[model samples]
Target: MSTQTQTETIVLQPTPHTEANTNENESTQDQSPPEVKWMYPKILSAGLSFFVAGVNDGSLGSILPYVIRSYDISTDMVAVLYGTTFFGWLVAALTNSTMTQYLDLGPILCLGAAIQILAHVLRVWLPPFGLFAVTFFLASLGQAYNDTHANTFVASLHGAHRYLGFIHAMYMAGCLVGPFVATGVASANVDSKWYLFYVFPLGVGIANLALVGASFRDRMASALTSSRRRERRERNASGGALKEIKETLSISGVWLLSWMVEYLVNVRDGDVKQMGYVPAGFYGGAFLGRLLLAEPTHRFGERRMIFIYAVLCLGLQLIFWLVPNIITEAVAVSLLGLFMGPFFATGISVGTKIFPPELQSSAIAFVFVFGQIGGSVFPALTGIIATRVGVQVLQPMLVGLIGASGLSWLILPKDAELHRD
Candidate 1:
């Protein structure tokens, strides 16, 4: 049977036997405690997890100079840090679905939270440079798990597009906060006390764990168990993780979006290289764009509007490239960020619509892993190339990436019906 057909059967499967058994099932369900709804608290907690991830991701660039100073390392050496991050996401991509088969959602989330906490604990003490790099791997693994699951859960809810926007906005909010915090802590001591900034996320990580536990406690085990059983039954016909990974990777949308985000984040700041605060404007623009553009993008249609946004981003990149003034470059970069902000969430949203329901989690996880690849590989490549050529190459590189992203969107499979807002 086809994967979609098999999934439909699993979902529509009837209870064995007859009316009495059906009545008994209904009675049992009626007596059971009310199902945990996707209440505000649950949504908020999910958003917080993404927020934590954002802070971790955002702080790196801002504090990188401090790290370079403290470790006496060259800029190119920082590629190792991003390399470790890709490793973490790779591990998550390989293991996420398999882990879900054996563990409940709550436990999985807790595990991710614990991993992040451990990373922060290591960071707070100003460990060796090697250890610091290891911390990113640990943290990225945690983020991969937390973010993939949280995104899947949120995307399944009512008004999912809006909620996805809100959660991603929270992530941007964290990214926005990270720079200020890292810069502040770094400047205050100027003696390598910048590592102390990790203490902030350490506290936030604990709260993230607590909130995930509390909010998901009721349904985590049962829901995950049922999901696994269904997945197992389907696996025989559909193949397993390898098959799903192949399917996800085959999707052109995944690769294109990955390239877009990678270039957008890594290259946009190339013009004003030393000013750490400048990238924050990019993130801030992304934050606002996700918040403000969610509705318009949906109203106009994801595929169409995304292409429009990409064109706008390309225009901004050209201006940033040709413009001589740093102020103009910064403004262009921020506008580029604004245009690019909705791409990630929208891409995932489209994935959910395009992929089979049973494969959504694995598919989304795989897409995200590819994104991590882009995020890590392109930046490292940029760093290596910038050392030889000038950082000025970032502009034309961004233009190429943006153009490719638009073309990719143009060719992605069009849904017969748009997902309701």
Candidate 2:
């Protein structure tokens, strides 16, 4: 969908002339004195934030064994870190919409970067095990803030789907780089300096903060004030943070897309029973698919192509399930990743088109949080079930999930008019 079509679908309540003039005056006064051309900078800043987040996410597994050895902890104890990470995302899910009510884009992004930097700093020094666990919480919290806002902003731009693809591809690229760097750093002096791997993320986090601050500085205060003023002027009863969250949670697309991603992640690793390198093939395919298929997916239609991708992914999963050969499984998994890559960005694009501008950030955040929930919960569920039904069940489970995802997508409202909040 085009930006114009999206804008047209929103029904903004008219403000009284007197109040409008007052708001205009206040908005003008609130804006920064110096104007900045922020388009490219914003894009770069958003991409860098994703890169930092990806590095944080991907490097953890590489460094985990070292952490286990250093702390003299069992493998099961590592679940604490994952729990903390989930808690961080949970916090974001509950607070992000409310935070945006008071904090401007620049301040929020800066705050997230600061939190991430603090996380890395603690890790690089090899803090106590408990402190190290806390670091994951901080990093995840920071990621939640940065990623949700960046996605919302990018989804509003012209050719948004393509840019979304580019930013996500950057994330996958960072993921690819992280394991190598962390493994290399940890292996250098396996006993002592494994913690130094965090230095890289710390440096990148600083750069992320700088870029975001520079890009969004001029509009920071004004954007917040303007949005609030518009909400008040329009007398939008549903504009409150709570209401936005509720509405976002109610959307079908949010749940379906979340399920799709959860199934994708679980199926690729759990079902295929592949070695580490094979999963890398999946990520590599996804990276290329996002870069190569982005434009065509956008041109063809996000809603239409998503179902097609889901079907393709489902077929590949079936092949992987029935086929016994590791080579064929690897090939099928990579192709599945290629098919699934575009779904996420396309889903975000769909949200942008269907949601009101004022509620975009919260809606997108809710969708992402839903995705995170599924990604964490379903895999854990699969693990427990695997203990009983065996890991072989993973393939059929994924097939069912993918089928449901496609059906849900088919029922979702498309290009529907939304009331401005």
Candidate 3:
């Protein structure tokens, strides 16, 4: 039995009252809390972790320019530092399923927060760029675990669609705040300003740590009982982690989705953030896009919305490429952010609803891991193109990649399949 949406009633099996059944059996079953009632807060609380993750990642990217200038590093080295975050995600994607088997959701979330806090402290104390990059990777690795686990946990909870949207939107909210807060701090002090970026996350991380402790007991009790049954079966299977991974990779739709995100990032590739006007424009648009359109877009139907967004995304990339003046580029990026803002959230909402609960976390991770792959590969490709062809060609290449992702939308399952029980 399943309750896919929050508005829906709890779905549970009724126990039979046979000749052998006794009064004690009825009392125990009667005492159990309704599934829907218990699941609501669990999903909501888990969503906050995604919020913290967005704040952590968004703030770092926003402050990257300060780090580069402060350390007197080459541009390529700076890119490598960003690249390490992707490397961390890649490593997490590879190992997460195995790790989840032994650990409870609450412990995992708390540990992730702790890791991120330590990484922040390390960045503040350590002088060298190498350590900075290493710490950033470590932080991302922690985030990766929390992100996947949170996605998994919420997918099992009540009202998957609304919960998924809120969770992802919270991440967007964090993204919206991170740059503004970091930039504010940085602008206040010209010298030694990079250290200022750590302030917001350090505070949020502390709050999140406390929340984890409050919810840990109830959430873990539910998670262990549900996940353990699956774990036992997996253990009984003769094939090990490598086999599980290979099996996961073999799914056609999963690979196709990964390709979709990889291409999307290719279209979005470059240092759009570090430049004064461009990052501001992109995220500013993203902030407005999410606020104004996320709910309506979801209401219209996630699949069709993605298709429309993809087309608009392609156009935005084209505008950035061919249009003259930094102002025009900024406008184009804003539009890009506006259209692309809901893409990941929409993908996750639709993907979770379509896949069975057992497969939900891995599937969400699969899609996000592709986004990470895109984050890593596309920027490097753009670097090569900019060096060889000219920076002017970057937008046109983005247009092309956007078109590729849009084309893949043709093969995605229809809206009916998306909402099916």
Candidate 4:
């Protein structure tokens, strides 16, 4: 049954469940709690986790030149990193709900942090080529767990769009810093030891672990006890999760939004070049965009406002394509980033509002998985296309992606992106 929404903020409510499940699972922590004081700390921890993920993800572009030279790998071999990162997220996306069943949120976050830290540690020593590629797997898994749960957790709070922006902006902030630090470290040594860049994220990853543990101490209790009740809870959780997954996949907006983010980032050679300074501007633009979403979104409802922003993004992307000047290109790219920054988090916000609490964890996980599939497939696809068609193809390719992204935003439900499951 569809849960109708009269206002944009009404997304906090979930789809109606059967009477039996509603009463039994009513305490499922999907609503904003009456007690708001402690939530701030947990939210801060969640933001920090996204920061770590940004650093890890952002460092790769800066360090890739070094990897190619040092490892003597062909361009095709580099695709392995994307594959590993994709699969790592795929694994986390698949197993995250099950882990939630067996472990509390705090421990699960700690597990992700630990894995990311391990990946960075291995990188600092300049592991073998194959081993270095595998590190991305560890990093992506760590990111998916901490950030996805953090997103769902924050979406449950009051004024969710604001908090969602806070965490996602923290991610952009990390992306802004990652390449800056990586470039400096890699260029410093006479030997050009790009591996040293991992050290920065390693320290941050350790701090992320501490913050999650300290902030979420109340929910950190071990949940490994075996019993009939535990077994029943797992079974119920699994069943609800499957239902949510089915419903989430049925929504066109979910898939469209996922493709938007992937296309924007992956098609680097198209209208956008891998110019270091220009990309930094884009990340910085995204930082400001996410941080400042409240006023406009409130003034014009989210559904309508987001569509406007997307149309503006398409226009900016066109300017980037047609203008021959580097300065114009830089300005257009940055502005484009500003408009497109909210794509991923907005989709997650819709999922939280539409799916029931029992269905949410799994459904969100699957949505995340689809959001990521393009990241795995697009980099290699773009590279091969670039090799065959020349970099000029980026102009039209980007135009198509931006146009499609904007259209997809329009296709989302007018009422808080509601979907009847």
Per-prediction TM-score, please? 0.81, 0.74, 0.75, 0.79
* Per-residue alpha-carbon lDDT of candidate 3 for residues 1-421, written as tens digits (9 for 90 to 100): 1112110111111111211112434453443312432454555566677777777655654565566567875434555655777687666755555555555566777777778777777765535777887886887787766666666555554345566666766776676677677666665664646575676687777776777657655444324445453643343232222122211111111111112211222344533233422454565566566556667776777667767888887776666656654557667777887777666666666665554443444445555555555655555455455445543444555666667666655556564555432
Each prediction's Cα lDDT score? 0.68, 0.63, 0.55, 0.64
lDDT of 3: 0.55
Q: Of 2 and 4, which scores higher on lDDT?
A: 4
Model 1, range 235-278, lDDT digits (tens) per residue? 42443432333222312221122122223335543321245566
For candidate 3, list the clashing residue pairs, or say none: 5-159, 6-159
Residue range 226-263, candidate 4, lDDT tens digits: 55235424434444334333232311221122122223
- Residues 1-421, candidate 2, lDDT per residue (tens digit)? 3322222222211211221212334444432222224667888888999889878876654565467668987534655676677788777765664565566667777888889999999988878999998988898888877876777667656556678898988776666677667767876652557789899989999999998889877546624566664563343334343232322221122112212222333444432111423445556677787788888777766556778888888898789778866679768867976877776766666666565655554455556665654555454455456455544656667788777766656655565432111
Clashes of 3: 2
Q: Count backbone overlaps in model 4.
A: 2
Best of the two (1, 4) by lDDT: 1
Model 4 stretches with alpha carbons more than 4 Å out: 1-32, 224-274, 390-395, 416-421
Deviation from native of the Cα of residue 348 in model 3, angstroms:
1.4
Model 1 clash pairs are: none
Ranking by lDDT: 1, 4, 2, 3
